[model samples]
Target: MTGSGIHLPMQSIEAQHLAELVEQFLELLRDTEIGEDAALNRLTPVVYPEDADASAEFADATSADLLDRRAADARVVQAGLVALGEGPDAPQQELSLAGSEVDPWLRTLASLRLVIASRLGIEADPSPDPDDPRLGVYEWLGYRLDLLVDAADELDGV
Candidate 1:
């Protein structure tokens, strides 16, 4: 699957799980406070690690715009997921998304993964146990995001 040629097996249990993950991601976006949520803080990293003043200034100027874009991406992702889940034959069908849709989906998936990874404190853990449930979810999200990116790259001839 490449370009606008992505085809997801809707009838599979994996597809259903992906839809549920999207829903959960949207819910997290809805509940998060742009600058207040610890999970979201990962989205806006420090611009000047050694200079608190400069970093704060940079963050103050750019955080809102970044969060706004992320929120919009989340909405797009939610709409796409909802559309996929609708209709009587949706489950037993193959859902195809256009090339244009792929970008936002990719961004949203990356954002969701960031949030989950941050919340799970995976970044700070030097060696997380693979058996941990949170690590499992984080790994799953990374795998799905990788698949999307690979598909997009093939489509773009990258």
Candidate 2:
């Protein structure tokens, strides 16, 4: 059950990858100080693809794609956590979600963890937080858009 065009096995989810992604996202949060939105915007695509693009033909996405991906990723995270037996019945670990771009990122990462745990034959529950205040348009998304447009433009320029 390998993901299409993706190297990892779709059915054999990897918790490590999910964890690493979370770690990287946390780093981005740390790098982007409070009041700055650059970090989250840049990593938006990787964290959530729905907000990457929209209104385009085939395979196109909209800004909401980010939220969609977050939910999907959360499913993966649940799979992983369940696999590890780290769930409601298990001990809760401390996770810091401070800084300008931390809460949303953490939520997305948590979702991914559940997804991974599920793929590994485990049960996990990841509830979406609608009250998160960091849902604003961050510079990070613009940064990624800049790179994507630049790449597309470069190819077109060719």
Top model number, TM-score:
1
- Model 1, 2-103: lDDT tens digits are 344675545545556767776776665567766677787888888799999999999989987887777787777667666766745534766566777787
- Model 2 poorest ten-residue lDDT run: 1-10
Question: lDDT of candidate 2 vs native?
Answer: 0.37
Give per-residue CA lDDT, model 2, range 101-136, as digits (tens). Answer: 232434564433333333332334433333432222
Checking candidate 1 for backbone clashes, the offending pairs are 3-155
Query: What are the lDDT figures for the candidates, one per model?
Result: 0.73, 0.37
Q: For each candidate, how many residue pairs have backbone atoms clashing (under 3 Å)?
A: 1, 36
Candidate 1: deviation at residue 112, Å?
A: 1.1
The window of 10 residues in a row where model 1 has the poorest summed lDDT is 1-10
Q: Relative to the unseen true structure, what is the C-alpha lDDT of residue 26 in candidate 1, on a scale of 0 to 100? A: 63
For all predictions, the C-alpha RMSD in Å is 3.0, 17.9
